[model samples]
Target: MASSLHFLLLFSSLLYNFSIYQAKPFNPTDGLIFHVKKDVSTLQYVTEIHIGTPLLLSKLAVDLGGPFPWFNCAPSSSSRLVNKRSIQCLAAKPKTHQYQGSNKKCHIFTENRITQMAIQGDLVEDIMAINQVTDGSKTGSKSITTVDYNFQFSCAPMLLLNGLASGAKGMLGLGRTQMSLTSQISAQLSSKLQFIICLSSSNGVVLHENGHRSSNFRTKIPDSMIYTPLVNQVETPHEYVINLKSIKISGKKLSLGIEEGKIKLSTIVPYTTMESSIYATFTKAYEQTATSMNITRVSPVAPFGQCFSSRENDGTLVGPKVPAIDLVLQSEMVKWRIHGRNSMVQELLG
Candidate 1:
């Protein structure tokens, strides 16, 4: 009920803001930023981005593996992307069946298998207003400015909004495809591209940074930050996949028959999942280690097969004092240590 009420308030606020909008492009600044939040019920990470003139606010679900971004837009004769030479500046035009609206207008259809739905919508362009935070060395604090980015997106049908968080009008694609938001921005920049996603318990942030003047921007390093090179596969061209060399439990390597070729990072998924065989081995190993420490096991929960008695005195500041899991990446040098803080889920069962 709380989630429902929150969604309604957001939707109502959007309607109020949409009623007043002016068509005037703001001169774009150096950076573009998106403020993010996590949906409690859906477990989907969402971000807010203002679009068009006067910057109408739109909340979109962040889809890290999605190929392109789209929104559930109300049908209007506002504008269309067309030219005498080509459709959306492409050499080839879309066939009649591929499009929904008309010949002159172009559209990009994307499907979300998790929701068991597809977005068949028109390709449109709008000014995306992003709040930029720059180094305000003189002011002794971070200075902020709203940067303008001419963004290309899909104006999807109303029915396509089903199964998504109520207030999320669309999906924000962050995949590696050409139509993805980052790829589009990279095209505009015509330089090397690198983006950052920082998720937190509070409000998260996403930054679209340009690499042209690489020398100018330097981020201070934290020793705790782990690094791994991303691996690209021929099969999944649009996914950001990483090489996972092995898995360890309390510094002891687990025996495995197969090595997972790559692991894909995603925010849409609430928890980490593994292949059936690998998962079976993982749970067995965890249970063995946990029992060795005299930690009593409880009735299993849905989705999570291994359940523990949280009432036990064996607890830490972060979570239950259990064996830590480590994901050995490309090499032994880089291992993502997953402490109890990350691996345990405390559920208040009645």
Candidate 2:
């Protein structure tokens, strides 16, 4: 998550109105939300979405770079909502576009970029049960109410579910597309085209209708949120890419050539990875800083090249006491700092 995963989600076009059974109807402008959590074994963040009647809950893996969301399912209850204009053939591969269907009904072509497979799925529409929270704005007490929403999603076969969380029934598309999670909810439930995703949050995910900040949910750091312009490259409009000016260790800038770096955020990867040239310079600086701090270096591990004997050193609350690794973006004032917990991984050997 640290610096590897992107800080963005997707959007969709399919719209729907909200309804409640017994209580007064909720405002259409209120934010809609679903519960999301991180799977320890697979390291994939998943969210529970209530789909179909009788409220059948389905676990979907959250993908930041993924365009449209699709899941492995039989989808007997949901009806077909095939796109009349176009259909997605391959979700993520070398080439991407609508796979045209001549005579037969079009099956939406989508895939999980993380699993690296394409799925020709039938677009299905169903009544979705979404959680709506009262922020005590119009009402004094904070309470949660379940509202029904109708939306469209793609369904694939069970064979395509590979390299994904065993418990995950499907993938949640939170990327920049016409069929992304945010876009659909924003278009239908609320007029505002914005949604908040607390990836490391312990509190419940609630969409604010009046756009008021709540003490219950917040960022990891208090009063710390950096906003920068997102660069829209026509080449990869769906991919979340941010402009990184430079990398600094202990406030010292490293030589990463003249070209400005563009980092792509990922939902699949758990840790940050760099090219050999960048790794050489980055790790060398960190190792030197660790050496000065009297931290012991151990044998190499599988994925990580630099292993440290963390037992010898009492690290900070975050992790080991090492020099700060920062990603300077846009300007010197805007910096994404990577502390110990995120910078070093603690390993246990048998």
Candidate 3:
């Protein structure tokens, strides 16, 4: 659990530095910036994307773990007029597969095994726009400058996500695969093939297309930001893997079972979801630490394992004051500190 907590701590610290990178000079015509909207109920960030000739507004989940962009669309007479038009123009042509390797059939399953969204139609090129602005004047309404591009994307006819992905209409994959949006639009970007996602309270998230380069054209990294080399591409071609040394919680170094003459523990940054067993291991250690500190534990929340009773009578869950947790990376002499909201989950009773 210390390792998991430390991972999140490290991620948050990097996110803070990324927030500063978002204040650079951005040309609306050169690069596209999507306005991220965080869903309070699901804690997922979504953005609006316009597709087709008349511009069909569709909400898509900002998923970095996914490899392809798709939406929940079904071909039916009762469907919306915009969707029907989009389907006719996008999927009426001959079916074209967009997967890598020899797999002709493209089946996309979410991290949660319960829901499966399959790509069922031809891959077609269509106009995709982000950050659309409208001017409301007394004369008439007009659209401001928007970053639009004609890109190829999958049109999913059968979407079985149920309510698991109700936070958005579909998912926009930013993965490393060729079918991802980032790879498709790599020619238009000025910097390296990289992006930054900065989450904040003011603006949900500010995503920079070129995060490595500063405004002055100098390649510089912040002092607080730590750099770790990505793992070998031979091992993980479509994922960003990094080396993790160990985790320390309250001066206690948790063992990661590092054997002699073996490679250190390498982990991938799971942008979307992780297994329950893996999450349980960390939560178990967290609960044990809370108990040792004489912190009273309450009934278990649905998803969250560790929960404490609030002092007030509002049935609000209180966060326990835990000791500092550190995540040590094997790449460099980097240790990230984890505390506060990054290590605790608050549950409210209705």
User: How big is the positional error of residue 91 in model 3, measured in Å on the Cα after superposition?
Assistant: 19
State which candidate has the highest TM-score: 2
lDDT of each: 0.65, 0.65, 0.49
Candidate 1 lDDT by residue in tens digits, 1-350: 00000011010001000112333332233345566787887777789887775557888988877777788754433334533235353521222453334466664555653485875566777777666655433444443466566766777776777767668888898888777787777677664556777664434666676632331122433346777887776876777777777789988898766555457777676777776777788889999998998888988988788998867746787557998888788888888777786677778867
Return the lDDT, model 2, position 48: 84
Worst 10 residues of 1 by lDDT: 1-10
TM, every model: 0.81, 0.82, 0.65
Backbone clashes in model 1, listed as residue pairs = none
Provide C-alpha RMSD values for all models, in order.
Answer: 8.0, 6.1, 9.2
The TM-score between candidate 2 and the true structure equals 0.82
Q: lDDT tens string, model 3, 62-117?
A: 66545556665434222232232343333223234355665433233333212433
Order the candidate numbers by lDDT, best to worst: 1, 2, 3
Q: Backbone clashes in each candidate structure, one number apiece?
A: 0, 6, 1
Candidates ranked, most accurate by TM-score first: 2, 1, 3
